[model samples]
Target chain A: MSEQLTGADILIRALEHEDVEIIFGVPGGAILRAYDSLYDSSIRHVLARHEQGGGHMAAGYAHATGRVGVTFATSGPGATNLITPLADAYMDSIPVVAITGQVGSRSIGLDAFQEAHTWGISMPATKHNYLVTQVDEIASTIREAFHIASTGRPGPVLVDITKDALIGKAPWRGPGQLDLPGYKPSVKGHPRQVTSAIEMILGSQRPVLYAGGGIIRAGASEELLAFATQQNLPVVTTLMARGAIPDSNPLTLGMSGMHGTYTASTAMQRSDLLVTIGARFDDRVTGDPALFAPEAKVIHVDVDPAEIGKIRNADIPIVGDAKAVLGQLIEAGERALEGAPAPERSEWFSTIAAWQRDFPLAYDQQPDRPILQQYVIDELSKRTDADTIVIAGVGQHQMWASQFWGFEKPNTWINSGGLGTMGFAVPAAIGAQAGMPDTTVIAIDGDGCFQMTFQELITAAVEKIPVKIAVMNNANLGMVRQWQKIFYDNRYSATELSSSIPNIVMLAEALGCAGLRAESPEEVVPTIEKALAINDRPVVMEFVCDPDAMVFPMIKAGGSNDEILMGPEDL
Target chain B: MQHVISVTVENKPGVLARVSSMFARRDFNIHSLTVGPTEDPKRSRMTVVVDGPEMEQIVKQLYKLIHTLKVVEHVPGEAVEREIMLVRVNAEAQRRGEILDAATIFEAKAVDVGAQTITFEVVGEPSRLADFLEIMKTYGIVSLVKSGRIVLAKDTKSATKKQRKSA
Candidate 1:
C-alpha cells in the first residue's frame, strides 16, 4: 500500500501540504532526486552561495514572514554544512524546516562518497529528525516536522530522505489524517488553574505582569495589552518578549535579564503578584532561581506546561495556550470586578517610574576617549522609536543595545537569547528587513560576531532589502573577557581575539552598500545618521569602542543579583 | 544522581546532535549513549542513561525535546536497562571450560575460544558488568571491552507521554 511513490513525489506533496512558497538551498549531487521533484513544483527554489547561507536565508524568511522557513541540501557536505544555521535556529526558537537528501539506506554506514551521518551531526541542533526508510512515511513525516517546528516553543526540525526513497515510486496517499494520539498540542488553558491564578492576581496589592515571546507566537499581543490596561498592571518583557507589549504603553517596563533595566529588575524584586504570561523565566532573565521574585507568588500561564516553574517556582501554573488563557482571564476578571472598585497599586507604579526617571539610560562623555558602544546605541534609540526593528548579536555590544535601545513594538527586537549566539544580528536583521521592507531595520553586531555571517551582505545587496548594521568593534570577544576578568581573577586567557577588521567602508562599498566608521564619540552620531540616510542599499558602520569596557550589572556565575559588578573598577 | 537514558528515535540525520546538544544546553552531563538498529529496522534505539537529580524535569523536557522520539526512563530500581561487556581473561586450557561454565550461568557467549586465553560476552546492567569484571579479574583478566550502557523501557508504551496526559 505504501509503494509506487518515490521520495521526490513525497517531498513535493509535503511542501504543498506545508503551503511552502519557497525552498532555499544550494543543490549538490546527492540530493538531485529531491531537486528533480522541485523542478515542476510551484514553490520557488532559491539557490544560495552556500548550503549554510541557504539555512540562514530560510531562517530570515521565517522570521520576517511568521511562517515556517524551508531549506534543502544534498547529502554529504551539503547536509553537514547546515549544522551552524540549524544550531542557530534551535537556540533562538525560530521555526525552520530543513530537508536534506541522503545516500541510500544500504549505503548509510558504508561511507559511500557523499554519505555522511547527517542524523548524528544534526541531532544536537534540531527539535527532532527523521530518516524515512520507507516511502509511505514521507507525507506524515513532513507534516509532523512542520507541526513540531512551529508548535510549543517553535524550533527547527530536519528531515533527511535517502536517494532511494526519493527515486522509488510509491502510491501517494497523502499524509494519512495525522492521527498521532500522543501529538496533540495544548490549545486550551486549564480552567481550574486559571481561576486560581485570577484569584491570586485579584488578591495582590502590588502586582506586575511579565510577558514573554509566547504572546507573540500565540498572536495574543492585543489580548496582553487589553488585560494589562484593564487590570492596571505594569508589564515587563524577556528579551524575546520585547514586542509583546509596546514600550510606549504607560504600564510597559523595559526588557529584563542580564542586561535588564534597573526599573524592571526592581519591579520584579518588589512585586507581590508576578503574573508570567507566555514567558519561560530563563536563567538569563531570572539571575538566580533562589532569590528571583522571592516575595511574589507567581502565576504562570503558558502553552507549554514544561516551562512552568522550570527556572523559578510557580505558585499557580495554568498550562494552556496564552491567547486562550488570556481570554479566560479577561472574562474571569470582568466577572470578579463587577460593581467592585479596582485596586490601584499607584505606590508601586510610582516607585518604578521614579527609578526610570533617575537612571534614564545615561552615559558619560569622554572628550578625548574612544567611542562608547552604549552612546551609539542610545543615539540610535533616540533617532528611531518602536517602529524600527532592531536585531543584535551576543557580546558586550548586544548587552549594551538591549539596555540602551528603547524598543516599542513586539517583533521589533530580535536576539539569540537562550543560546547567546554570536553573529546572529546581521543576518537576522536582513531577515526582518525582508519581512517589513518599509520599516527601518537596524542590526547591532560586535566586531567578532559580525564577521561570522558577513557573507550574507551579498544576499542583502541582491535582494535589495538593505539593513543598516552597526558594528561595535572592540577587537576582542568582550563578553568572555569580562567573565574571565571577574571569575578568573583578571587572567585574560584565550579571550584576547584580534583579527583584521576590514575597513567596513571598503567592505560595504564592495558589497554595494553605504559604509561609515566612527573612531570617536563625536563621530558616532553623524555616522549613524549617514547610514540611516542610505535607504537603497545596506550600510555597515564600524564603531571602535573601548576594549577594556565591560557590561555592567554583571551577575557572576552562581552569584546573586546583588553581587553584580558594574564597571572596570568593580571587576 | 546521574542517569544513563536510551532514547529510541527514528533513524534520521542530526538526531544524536539534537539529544547531546539538549544535554549540553541544560548543563545535563550525559554519562554515555549508544545508538544502533533496533528490532524494528526503521527505528533506531539510543541507549542513553543520564544522571541528574531533577529526573522529573529531565523527563518533562524530553517530551518538549523531540517530535518522533520516545524517552523511557530505566533507572536501576524501577525499570530494566542493560549493558554488555566482553572481557578477555588469561585462563589455562584446563580452566577454559570452567570459565565457559561460569559464562553459561551468566547467559554469556564464548565469542573467542582463544588458545591460552578466553573471551566471553556478558550482557547485564552496569552492576552486572562490575561483578563480571571483578570475577574475571580473579582469572587474571588480560584485557576488557565494555559496551556503553544501552537502555529500554520495561513496558511497550511511552511512559513520559502517559504521565503528561495524566498530568
Candidate 2:
C-alpha cells in the first residue's frame, strides 16, 4: 500500500490531509518542483503579483475562516518579500504557514544563486520555522508547521525545504507523527486564580471588561458576552477585538484606546477593577503606561503567559485560553451571584453616559464640499449587512472604519491591528471572499495604502471574488499629514500622494472589474448601490474625500489618554 | 541585577538564533551565553546570563517560543556555576616558571607548551577566570578563549546514588 512519491507530492498530500482548500503564492525556480506537483493536486492555487500579497491573502483567509492560511514562495527575494506578511501575522497572532524552497542542500551556505538564509531571516518573524534537508521529513514538517501555526496564541510558521529534497523520491507515509517534546500550551485557568478574579469582579463597584484579539482567536465571543451580560459589566473591545461584543449591545462601551470612544476610554481610566481578557495592553491602547488604568486593580487573562504583566501589572493573572477562562469566570460569577446579590454600580453607568454624551465621535459635514472620509464609512456601515466582513488597511481610513462600522459578530471585522500594515486591505478582502464565497467582503482602504498592494486586485478580478473595495481617495497620506500638521507646525512633507495619481476608477476598469466613482455627497449612495449590485466580479468604488478630515480624540504618542484632544479646535 | 537562566530547547536549526535575537529585539543585554547539546540528542541546553531590570518577563517570553521546552532561573547562591577559559601566554624561558606557578596556584592545567608560549586551561567561576586572565595579561598573553558560564542547580539528593542503592 506504500506508494513512492516525490517530496513535493508528499507536501501536497499533507496539505490535503490538513484540509487546505487553497494556497496563494508565486512560483520561482527553486519552487518549480512543488508547483509541478500542485498542478495535479486538488488544492487550488491563487497566483499573486507579489509574495507579500500571497502571504497577506493567506492571513486574510485564515482570519475569515479561523483556519491555518497557507502560502508558498522560493528562496532569496521571494522569501524576503514574505517577511512583511509574516511579521504582520506574528503581530496580530494570525495562523499562517508559508512554505519556501531553498537552494540545494550542498549549496545552502556557499552563497549560491538565489540563495538567502530564509531560516535565519524568518526566525524572529515566525512563531517557529523548519529547514528540511531530507525528503522523508516533508510530511511531518508540513504537519508540524500547521499544528504550530494554529495552536495557542497562533502565529506564522515557515517551512523551507531544499530544492533537492523537493525533487527527491521518498516512501509515502501519509502524514507522519509530530514529535514535538517541548511545545506544551496550557488551556485551562487554575481554579484558585479563577475564583480570585471572580471575587474581585464581585467586590468592585465599577468594573470594565477590556477585550482584545484573543477573544476572536479563541472563539470566545459568546462566552465573553455571557459573562459580561450576567455580571452587568461594561465591555470595551480593543481594535483587534472589535466584534467580540456587538457594538449595539447595551453594555458595550465601544472600542477603547487612543482612537477609542471617549466613553470607553473614560470607563477604562475611571474603573475600580479592569478585567482584561485575551488583550495585550499595546502601546496604542495604553497611550502612556503610567497613566493607563491607574485607578483600577487589573485582572489579566490571556492564553500567553508572557502578556500578563508585559506592560501594566495585573493584580490577578490567569494564563489560559480565553474561552476556557471566560467559561470558568462565568461559572464562578453565577455561583457568587447565587450566594450574594450583584454589586450596584448605577453611578458608574451614569458617569459613562455623561461622558458619551459630552464627548461623542463627531465629524464636521460641509454640504457644498467634497465628502468626508468618515462620512463615507458611516454610510457604508449603515448600508451593509450585519454579517458583512469589513477589512481595512492602516491609517486614518482604518481608524474611521473601526469607529464607524457596527460589528455584530465575531470574525466579521478583520484588520492588521498590531502591525498597522498599509496595503493589507484589498488582498485580505480577496482572501476573505475566497474563504466565504457567499458573504460580502469590503476593503475600506486609503488612497496611499491602496496604491501599495493594489496589484492584487487583478487576482480578485480574475478569480471572480466579487469583493467590494471602497477607496477613500483623500489624495494624501492622511495619518502622517495629520501628524505633520499638529506636531510639525503644518509642515507637509512627503505624505502627499496627489501628484501624478492614476484614475482609480479607470484603473479598476482596466483591471477587468466594474469601476464607479463618487465625487459629491449625492453620488456616494448611488456608487455604493451600484457596486453592491454587481456580484459576478469585484468592484472598486472611489470616493473623493476631503483631504483635511482628520481622525479625532487624538492622544499624541507618549501622551496620556487623559490629555486627549477632541479636535483641531483643541489644538 | 544579573540573572542566569538555563533554557532547554529542541536541537533544531535556527533555534539559537531565535533565542539570541529575542534578547536583542527586547533590548536585553546578554552578559554571556553558552549553548551545547544535552544528554537527550534532540535537545540542547543554553545558559544565558542577562543583565536587566526585569528577568521574569524574559523568562516568560522564552517560554512562549515554540522551540523552547523549559526555562529555569538559577538562584545565585544555590547553583554551581563554572566557566572554562584557554589562555596562551607569551611564556619566554624566563617567564615560563612564573606562568606555571600562577596556573598551579589557580588549579589550571597546561595543555600545550611552545618555545615562546604556553596554553593553559582554567575552569572556575567567571570572576575567578577574569582574575586569572588579568594576571596572565601581565605575562603578555598570546591568545584567549573563554566559554560563557554554564550552571547546574544543586540538588538535595543525587539520582545516581539513589539508583545505585536501590540496585
In model 1, which regions exceed 4 Å deviation?
A1-6, A36-42, A134-136, A170-179, A339-341, A365-369, A484-501, A520-522, A566-571, B1-54, B65-162
lDDT of 2 by residue, A23-50 (tens): 9999999999999999999899999989
Candidate 2 Cα lDDT to native: 0.90
Q: Candidate 2: where are CA atoms >4 Å away?
A: A339-341, B88-100, B111-119, B134-143, B157-167
Q: After best superposition, candidate 1 residue A444: deviation in angstroms?
A: 1.4
True contacts kept of each: 0.25, 0.53
Predicted model with the maximum lDDT: 2
Residue A401 deviation, candidate 1, in Å? 1.9
Q: How high is each candidate's TM-score? A: 0.81, 0.96
lDDT of each: 0.78, 0.90
List, for all models, the DockQ compared with the true complex: 0.20, 0.37
lDDT by residue (B1-167, candidate 2, tens digit) is 78888888889877888889998987889999999999999999999999987776788878777778878887767778999999999999988888899989899899999999999999999889988988998989888898899988779631121000000
